[model samples]
Target: MQSAEGTTAEHTAAKGRPTPKRREAENRRRGPVAPPPRTQREAIKRMRGNKQSKEERRKAAAERRERMMAGDDRYLMPRDRGPVRAHVRDIVDSRRHLMGLFMPLVLIVFATTLVQNIVVQQYATLATLVLLLTMLFEGFVLGRVVNRRVRAKYPDAKDRPLSIGWYAFTRAMQIRKLRVPRPRVTPRDAAKVG
Candidate 1:
């Protein structure tokens, strides 16, 4: 039918070709650009690709752990990596840390508390507290010394992480055998490094 503007309904509905059915047009827009899976097997095959990628990631992580344990350094945590941190580790490892005695002393004190003698338990508890305070003081001193040495060695490097001192102190507190990236220097070798 003709309208006042001299346009017909057919002309309006037919731009280049007949207007597609609304449902068919919508479906076309929503359809996958990639070819649809032809069968359940194809869908499963695509899903299995994710498992393979995950397996690859797991293997990579295991290899990284192995490298870290072997002292490759590249895979070491940020707190443990870098030349200055390594030097700090060496210095702490070289000396006998009073903090290292804290654990054994604590165990002894704990054992004492298990005894029947109340007097002995009191003394043991007191001694344990005192020992802990002393160790804390010593750790502070150790951290300061480590920070000084690191600053001296790397005066120009100002981007050191804030935890460097704490990292050094903690490593110093650990028994030599338990320290990861196992101490490269002995007490005798420490003097030579300095």
Candidate 2:
């Protein structure tokens, strides 16, 4: 047995200070502390939150998603950020993207092949080939235009011409209504393409 001032084997070092006083705790003390929850529902509710906090978190997340989709710079993905990329998106969005029809044409050609008629299949294949060639030519022209505009606006910018041009081309391939980050300017307000 140890004396009052003597240390025992189980004794550890002191914390060096007393606990902090909380005004909120003093104000909240109505009686003895509440006992632990008893029912399963009560316990699970305590484990998560009474639904209010969970709902608040979910609402906040939804708001953040909306802002991200709205092209807020702070919430934008790395690829979509910066003034140049925003300009490219706006330019692409405001134009009627004929490439948007590529998917529909592909489906149409696929359906035509189901006819089993040699003449129909031949015409469908020829049309597809012609469309592909036209799309490739148009893509090249769009790239040139995008690069030229970017270079003109940001003469001293170190951005790669091919990358910016390719980015513009991809954005232009998307349907206006389906484009992520949504369109800011309508076709009526579109900048003239050179």
Candidate 3:
């Protein structure tokens, strides 16, 4: 206990610096290195000083949008964040589903009904009903298949079947060219289907 040569009598490395307090360590982690503000006005000025320039923010937003369109996880919406949803999207994109024509078929039916001929309108209505039934049937089958495959791949996935199943169904119904996070695989490149 009587050491005098700048050495501690204790059995320790003795770097001679006391540990930093938790609050100080947290502040350092938060990236603010200035001394504590002596007044409220200084604190307000510091807050405003931390903000980025408008150009910097715009560039950052554009970059984030690009990443989102490319299906980068960090920028994806909450509903699209997980690998399970990505797998579901890929599966839907890789296949040719009849429901993918639903939008075009609807337009065709609408156009046909604009004609004055009763027979043409009747036929258009009939065809529309038939297409709806077919789309529903195809969507049901696609949902089941995709859900099974997703379960096979991500067995421990926390996603519920209805959530991802509907996601697959809705994705399958969209026009391939218009799907967001554009198809990673073409119809011929479905290597991940297993």
Candidate 4:
């Protein structure tokens, strides 16, 4: 048998010139072959007589209705029902806002403590350490508050920090201090049919 590229297996019996495989391959590579076109009226009638099963028809009709309502009829595109990323962004934004609110007050307290110190040079390293710790603490406090509020609102939210360690401890503190209720939808509500 000869390959499409004209290489032949020696075991194959050659025809009068090239193998049958080579002739078939040459015909396939030469051009595209199209089936004959059907008459539009005949095609329409045939399609009308060919009915889909009731369930399939119902599903198709429902999809068509949805597309019509959405008003983008170019294609049957999938709908995105989740707002997870937006919720995460909201948490990040709230964290940043609260950080902005409390950072200045923390800095002022640190500055005052450093200013009245008996030995300025002696406390420089301690002051630096305090400042770093304060910034980190502020970030933690604000992050916890934001995350707690978000988690309470969206209990089933994926990628949320669920552990009660470190940041989770701070979240508990924020929940306690601010009296923020961790309101969540029940599992039954989540299991409800759409």
TM-score of each: 0.64, 0.70, 0.69, 0.28
Candidate 1 lDDT, 22-141, residue by residue in tens = 988998999867687899999899879878999999999998877886667789987687788788888888888878878888998999999999999999999998998998888888
Model 4 alpha-carbon drift over 4 Å, by segment: 1-82, 94-121, 162-194
RMSD of 2: 12.5
lDDT of 3 by residue, 47-161 (tens): 7766656668889999998898899999988988888999998888887998989989999999999999999999999999999999989888888888899999999999988
Pairwise TM-score winner, candidates 1 and 3: 3
For 1-194, candidate 2 gives per-residue lDDT tens digits of: 57688965566789998865796568567556757999998888886875779899899999887998899999888888988888777777766767877778888998998898999999999989987887778778878877787788778867798888888878877766777788788887674532
Candidate 2 deviant stretches above 4 angstroms:
1-39, 46-54, 192-194
* Global lDDT of each candidate: 0.81, 0.80, 0.87, 0.48
Cα-based lDDT at residue 70, candidate 3: 91
Worst 10 residues of 1 by lDDT: 156-165
In candidate 3, which residue pairs get closer than 3 Å at backbone N, Cα or C atoms, i.e. clash?
none
